[model samples]
Every structure is written in C-alpha cells, then in structure tokens.
Target: MPTAAHAHAHALDLGRFVMASPSSFHAAAEGARRLAGEGFEVLSEIDAWPGGPGKYAVVRDGALIAWTVPEGAGATTPFRILGAHTDSPSFKLKPKPTTGRLGWLQAGVEVYGGPLLNSWLDRDLRLAGRLVTLDGAQHLAATGPLLRFPQLAIHLDRAVNEGLALGKQQHMNPVWGLGDPSAEDLLGVLAEAAGVDPYEVGGFDVVVADTQEPAVFGAHGEFFASGRLDNLSSVHAGLVALVQAAEATDAEGAPIAVLAAFDHEEVGSASRSGASGPFLEDVLARIGDGLGASAGDRRRAFAASWHVSADAGHAVHPNYPERHDPANHPLLGGGPLLKINANQRYATDAAGAALWATVCGEAEVPYQEFVSNNDVPCGSTIGPLTATRLGIRTVDVGIPLLSMHSARELAGVQDPWRLSRAVERFFAQAG
Candidate 1:
C-alpha cells in the first residue's frame, strides 16, 4: 500500500486532469504537454525519423503516440504498448446550432455517445473544443458555464417519478438565454474565448460539459468523482508509467515502450484519429522503416508484442447489486480489474490473462475481476479492435468505476496510483 501522502497526491493530480479536459482535443493536448515536459521529442507525421534508443512522440489531430526505445533494442524488438482512449460521451454542438423557442435561445446538440441524459439535466454546463480560423490555424477554447438544461417540474408531469424518457432532439437542447438566436451569437462567444474575431471563427468542433469541479470524498477521502473518468483515468496512468519507465529503464533489454491514446472510441472509433483507423499501424510501420528493419522483422515484432487496453469498468453499484455478476463483482479501492467476456467483446484470452496476472503479482498490486451478468450483454474497449487490427496479443483491464457514462463518475482514490505502478512494472519487463 502507498503511504497516505502519496495517495492524496495522486488523487489531486487526477482531479486537475479531469477538470482541465472537457473534450478529446483538450485531452490530447494535455497528454502532449506532459510528454514534452518529460523530455520526449515531438515529431510531425510528415517528417523523417531518427535512429536508436530515445524518447519521441507524434500527434495527429486528437490522437497521440509516444514511445521510448530501449537502450540496445532494434526495430525487431517487441513492443509493450499501453492503449487508452481520450473521448467521453457527451452532447456535441452541430455546425449551425443556434435556435430559439418561446423567447429562449438554445444550442442544437447531437448525442455523441451513450450518455445518461438525465444526468445532464439541470446542471451548469460549459462549451469547450477546438476552433479553426479562416487562415487555417487551430485554437483551443474553454469558456465558463454559459448554458443550462433545466428539467420540467413534477407538478407539470405528475408521473415523473415513474420514469423519464427524454427525446434527444426535442428536450436535450440546452438554453443559453432569451433572445433571437443566431449563429453569430454563438460564434461571437467562441471567438472571444479563442481570442479571434467572429468572422475568423470559420469552423468549430465543440461539446457541452458539466462545470462542477471534481470532488474527493469518503470517510478518508477514499473515492473521487468527476467526468471523463471512463478512459482519461487510464490515460493518466499510462502517461505517468511511461514517464517513469523512461527515466529508469530495466537492465534486461526490454521491448520499446509505447503509449497510444486515440480519440473517438465512444462513437465507434471510425474517424481518422480513432482506433479503427490506420493511425497506430501507420506509425508502427514508419518506426520500423526508420530503423532499417526488414518487413519480416516487423512481422516478427508484431507476433511478439502485447497491448494492454485500459478503460473504466463498471463497479458493483451499492444500490443495484443485482446488475453485476454475483461472484465476479469488482469493488472500489480494490485495485484494478481485468474485464473478461466469452463472446469476444473483450480481447482477453488465457495467454493474455496470464500475462496480466503475472504483471500484477510481480508488482504486488491487489487486483479484481469483472464479468457482467450472464444475461446482460457486455461492453467493449479498444482491446478487441486493436488486437483484430494489429494481430497483437491484447488484454482488457481498468479501474472499477460507477455511473460510467454519467456527466460525473465515481472511482477509488487509490486505484489510479495502483494501476500506474502496475503499468510501470509491465513496461519494465524484458520479454
């Protein structure tokens, strides 16, 4: 177990990361900033690569890949890849989102993923994303709370307690204020936030987010709550582990360590910067070519490589215990969980599962298992997609969480550091 001070520090860092990242673009930028601070050289996709053991990273819009080449390893060496996504389920603004009804101004929003809609109602919301200027430069913007989606009073709908069925198009648009709504109004607000003129705001990729700050609570501050914990928590752990592994490489000539964070996993990961796309493969091939490795060598490396796919898993809910498997339930503050499914929803198999067990056991980190109820369908992560795409051995894993797709989610305070330490140990492995 970590000392009390170390646990508190890790929780504080996670809170700051969750509050700073309201969109995928912001999360990628944050990852890049941290990597650069740790002495990793940032590279462009169009540029040629350098040779031999060193720290390097590349960014493509909302996806990023960073790696540290081991001191005597060649391109044929296997890769220990840590995978996580940068996106969360939320309401994104359409290109022309301005509309008005009954003296109220509202922004037309499209549901981006499978979010708990009721959790978004009546909360103070803000807008944050990337903006493109007429000159072709991009800028990031995050404005304070500027919209509200108030719920209907129980007096108006007497059966509200029965259930709430919300219409995505009708009841989900959030009101900013009362006025004759115009695209210019929203554009002007975004332009000011990005320090550009309204005319210069030629395009935007924006999303609505809750403005409440993350909180750490429980009898001893054992749990923390925030948005985007589904994968951002994994992102943080991978990043910290990669940094530590880079600083102190294992002497056993381990494979190159890589951290790959993609953007659109929540919406199916089909975009240019998504896991289903060619970003990871393209970069891997480029690295192999740069190191003068033959095609056969690259193939051999793939056969030997392993990927750890980390996402947030569902913790057994105290209020709804029956929703989880009775014997395979994961709990808060119990370290990380290995997610499994017999239906191939997850990429874990006997070989991959054994590797993860060894890593955790060697690090002395307590771990748990999570398998959904037999009758209920299981959710997936990038593990299956990446394994199918690259033919690399992959295992699905994550920290236990509650209200996973809610605007605000819950997780253990200690699990973040536990997962990080386990990943560090994995990267330190020689095989």
Candidate 2:
C-alpha cells in the first residue's frame, strides 16, 4: 500500500519531469539521468553485452533502454520489460524555416502527432529539445515564452465560432511576435537566446511549449493539467515497478526486470532507435545471450516474458461523448485502461488483458477498459510494434486523458499513482 505522502511526492516530481520534457529526445535523456542517479550505468549494446550484474543501456542518441542486474548475478536471466515512448505531438523545425515578409517573423512547425490543433491557441509557449552547435557541443536548451499563436480576434474572423478547420501547412503555423520578417533573421534570434553565435548553432529541434505549470486541478484537485504526461506518466510507473522488483527477488524462474523508452514514436518510429526497428529485440536478445540462455531456455523465457506497452488512453470527452464507444470510453480517475483494437493498432489480447486484470487484483489497484468509437479511426502506439517484433505477449495499458496530442494535456492526479502501483505488482509477479 502507498502512503498519502509517498503518492503526493511521486506525482509532484513526475509532473515536473513531464513539464520539462519539451520533446522525446529530452525525455529520454532526463529519464536516463534519473536512472543513472540510482546507480544505473549507461552502456552500449553495439559492443558485446557486458554479461554481468549492473545497470546498462543500449543507447541510440535520443532513444535509450536501461536495466539493472540482480545483485551478484549475470545475464543468465531475462527481465520484465516495460516499454513507453518519449515522443509527443509538438512542432519540429524544418530546414530553412522562417516566415512573415516584415514585422512578423514566426517559427514554422509541423504537427508531430495527431493533435487537437485549436487547443494551442492563446497559450504561452516555450522552446526546448537538443541542438548541435557549430562547436560540436551537445546542448539541451529549454527556452520559454518564446512564441504564441494569437487566434485571430473573433471580430477579425466572424466564422471562427460557427465552424473552423485547420490546414497544417498553412493556417496552423504559430506567430510568436510582430517584427520585420526575414528567412535569415531567426538564426540571429536563436543565437541570442542560446547565448551562442548565429553560425555557431549548427542545427536544432525545438517546439512551442505550454507555459502553464503542471498541477493537480479539478474542483477536488483530482485532475492533473500539464505537458507530456501521456508517456512520462508511464515511464515513471515503469521506473517505480523496476525498482520494486529489484528489491524483491527476480522471479526465481523469471527474467530480470527492464525499462525501455524510445524516441521518435510520434513520427512512425522509422529511426534506428524506434520500436519499428530492432532496438528492443536486439537488446532482449543480448540479455538472453549474455545470460547464456540455450536455445530452449531462451525460447521458454520468450514464452514466459510479458510486456506492458505503457501509453496514454483517451478519456470520453464530457463535451463530446458521441465520439466514443459507449462501452469502451474511460472516465477520469477510473483506473488503468486496457486498450484493445482488432486492427492491431494496440497489442492487447485476451490473454494480455486478463494478465493485467490479475495484476490489478494483486495490487488492489483499480482499472478500466478503453476502445475508440468504431466509426472513428484510432491512433497507434509502440504496443503492437514491440509485440510483433519480439513475438512476446503484451498488453496495452495507460491512464485516460483529454487533448492527447495537444501541446498541453490533462490527466487524473490519482492515475499515475495507481499505474505505478499496478506496474510494481505486475513485475513482482512472473517476471
């Protein structure tokens, strides 16, 4: 059981992490740093697996997978792997990006995920993510109050309230300020902001950020309003579970516990470090081979290994209940949502769902089921991708939320704690 103080502290700290992570790359680095603070060493699988007792990583720039070994043990065991993505729907800079002929230079950005476009209007925004300076120094910059998209005044566009549609390549672009516009002017502004010479900044991937501090909201403070919680909430849960499993014995007959967070999931995951690639599989294979798993033993371990693809779930919108399947819509503060889709957009199967039900029962954590309306298309996650790649049984689970792909999203304050507890219990069981 979790104490009230413990839950509060975890939720607060996790909220801060979510807010600070402006992009997937930043998310991965920060999470890895936190894990390293716990004595987890960053290692590369490109070299032979170290094959011993310690936390190591298979890192590919923004993407990373970190895990720890049993005390006084080696790779002879597999681990319970919890997977989540670091990417979310924000804007990315395009090559030769600049706009407004004069007195209105704005940054051009592409919608990363399928985000609700209008939610970005009238909000204070910031810029963050990794940038390589001309000096070859790797710097992560978090620049805020950097831009905004002032929705045309109602008077300017009377049809705005009646109905509005966005064109990603045209109208949705954010205008941060009013000044003489020039395609070449932005480099100067960025250099000034990053405290570097214009030519010294070689390249960057920055996005407009919501300036609202993440906090417990709602009339009773049950809701969490912030940024990037969709996956960070899941990452935090995975971390909590991995630590718990480390304290307990690795299932005498189970693989070691693992946590995998990859970047670029929002962009189709085609990168070398994404779920669509062999990072997860290669790492798992390394763990198996390092532990000296014979063909049969590794196969058995594969058969027994369970994965939880942690992501965020869509909660039925109070204002638009018609958009959800009556039997599948989840509500705020309900519980962990077991997401299912026959199209394989998600990886949950009957067996996987049932396994989570059992884990919830053990942890005494509440849970719910989520399915998008049949008439509408559903977004995808790393769940199915990882499941098919590793041939491992997997379940898709997450906390339900609103404005999923918006620059800022809301979730239940209670949900993160519940997820952490549930994942902890799940890993404590059969690997």
Candidate 3:
C-alpha cells in the first residue's frame, strides 16, 4: 500500500492494460502498436529477414516479437534478448455453452491454466479473445474484445467452504446477463464490437476475464492489484524498457534490444508461438543472421549473448509465511527477486544470478533472493528452454507477487517502474 500522493506518482498505467490483454493476441497487438508508433518497422515473417538498420517487429497468431538494431549493426552484432509470456489462467468460452438454472442462463467455460479455482468465485468477469470473421464468403478479419465470466454469490451456496468442489464441465460455467445465452447471441455482440457481420464471425477463442483493471491498493498505493498481473506486470515492464531500449541502441550494436513475448506458456509451450516452439530459437537465430552472424558466427554470438527470462516470483504471504523457504522468503516491495532453484528449474546458475545482482547494484535497484525450500518442488519458466535451445547464458528474475494465477494478483507498485529502469539499463549495456 502507498499514500495517495505517492501512489499518483507511479508511472505505470497498469489499469488501462489489465483487462485489455485477456488473451495473448491482444497483448501482442498492444506492444506492436507501441513499437510501430516509435517508427519501428513491423517486419512480416512472410518477407525475407531484412538485415538493415532501424527497428522491426514480428507477429504470429497471438504473439508479437520486436527488436531494434543500431545504425551500423552487421555480421558481428549480437542481440540482447528479453523474454516473457503473455497468457494468463482463466475460464474460457466453449462451443455449445448454454446452461439455465432457476431461470439464469450460464455460459459454458473450460479452465485454461493452473489458477486457484477458489479465488475465481463471486467476481466480475469479462470475455476477451480473438475472433475470425468471414464475409459473404470472401472477406475476413480478426476481432478482439474483453468479455465477461460471472460467478455465483456466496449466499447462493451455503456449503461453499464445506469441502466445496466443482466439476469443470458442470458447476464452473458463468451466468451472464438475464436470458438464454446461445453462442449466436454473444457472437452478435462481438460482431457489433468489431463492426462485423454476425454471420461473418466464423470462429472465436474468447475467454472469461475479470472486469477489474489494475489499481493502486494499500496505504500509499505501494501495493497493486487487479487482474492478469502474473505476467502482464512483466509485459508492461518489458514494453516500457523496450521503448527506452531504442534510444540506447544508438551505440552501434553494442547492445541490440530484443523483446520476446511468447504465447502458450500457461498451457504447454508447444504451439507454433510457444516458448518450446521455434519462436524464440528461430527469432534469436534470425537476429544472429540480422547481425551478420554466419553459422559459425551464430554459435559464437550465442556464447556472448545473455537472456533474462522475466516472470513473477512468489511473495511471502502474510497468512502462510512458513510455506516459503525460511532463509529466502522473498518479500513484496523488496525490489526484484533473483530466483535461484537448485534443481535448475529456474535456469539461474551462479553466473546468471551474479549477473543480475551486479546489474541491480549498478542501477541502485534493491533486490531479494528466492528459492523454494528443498523439500518443496518448484515451478519453472522459459529460462531452461532458452538456455538449452540457444546455448545462451540465461537468468530468471522478477518482482515478487501474491496469488500468482488468481484473476487478481498483488505486486509492489514501485517495483514495476524500478524493474523497467533496470531492464532499460540491462538492454543498454548487456554486452
């Protein structure tokens, strides 16, 4: 929490972005817009890799990757890549969703990721995702919107806490406005939002999302909460630093700025756009080529390049502090946490960890350490995938967070901007 005055001073427009990015497509679009506005060229994957000066972007189905090469970059130039994901855990829309219980029509939904099912109850949810539209049999366009997923009230369920359970195909669907909700009805509404013909909407991948936006909470607004912070917080940080990375790249390929936001990490990163797929490796290799790295040079260039996989770290919870490693209980607002998992789940070895610590020190950014107790199995991220794929040195680090996959998560407000600043410094000097 922060005081009102201090809270207003925070630079992040977290609220504007929270609901807009319910799906990775929307996230990619937003970042692409920003980079394009900065005069960065939005490169078409359909085109051959253009190894010229200036900036460029690549957009897959639901993912966007971008970068800026200094004016004189050539075969010897290596990129400084920053990686993060764009998907979040949530309830998703189904094909034949229609349920009526006591005159209330519920929309069908399927769980998307490892969210705390309990926390999703009794919240205002919206539906959002990409829609593919086909015209009279000829024209087609993509549409995206933030839609809703409503939860039942506690009063409706007297035994909510009495070992409450829900069959995903049964009780978890949400009831929207009053009436029978056929896929047609909602598709019409979506068509209106996108200025398309309802008949033109061929298919969609919309998901339920919290209607709430990110907000400053706590006494001084030091604490932030709303929806989709699990990774959007990092997304915001990455974009801001990216905008700045453009300026710093004027140093002649000293440190080329690369932003990697992959899709499908929430599920398995197996999709064409997923971290486990060719998105990262292909993009990095292409960057090597863009910088004039031949096959032999690509290998050597990878040796010198370092990657920072940005994700949220688990924070010490007030009610369950003991759950964390006693010696490394990362606290919120304690700066960023350099996550180290002894099992290599985090991809942060001594060299990687030391790299981050040194960056934090030089930037005067306060930081903490986090590692799950040896007794507790830990989660993983793109760190290992990137390390193994490119043979590039990698590290995992991020702001500490509470309720990682919940519709609404908590993080330190100051940390968001602090991290952007440090990452800016990193991309400016990673070489």
The lDDT of each candidate is: 0.88, 0.76, 0.75
- Residues 1-431, candidate 1: write the lDDT tens digits: 44656767877897788788888888888888889999999898888887777888988887888998877777688889999999899999998878777889988889999999999999999999999998989899888999888899999999999999899988999999887775338767877998888787878999998899888899988988898898899999998899998986545677788899999999999988999999999888877887778989999999989999999998999899888898877888998988899988988899988988999998788889889899788999999999999999999999999999999999998898889888988888776
Q: Cα deviation of 295 in candidate 3 (Å)?
A: 0.9
- What pairs collide in candidate 1? none
In terms of lDDT, which candidate is stronger, 1 or 3? Answer: 1
- Which residue runs of candidate 3 sit more than 4 Å off their true CA positions? 1-11, 98-102, 135-159, 181-184
Cα-based TM-score, every candidate:
0.97, 0.91, 0.91
Ranked by lDDT from best down, the candidates are 1, 2, 3
Better of 2 and 3 by TM-score: 2
Candidate 1, residue 166: how far the Cα is off, in Å: 0.9
Per-residue CA lDDT of candidate 2, range 356-406, in tens? 999899888889998889899988889888888777788999999898877
The segments of candidate 2 whose C-alpha lies over 4 angstroms from its true place after superposition are 1-5, 45-49, 71-76, 134-137, 188-197, 249-251, 294-297
Top TM-score model: 1
Native-referenced Cα lDDT, model 1:
0.88
lDDT over C-alpha atoms for residue 264 of model 3: 81
For model 2, state the Cα shift of residue 75 in Å: 6.1
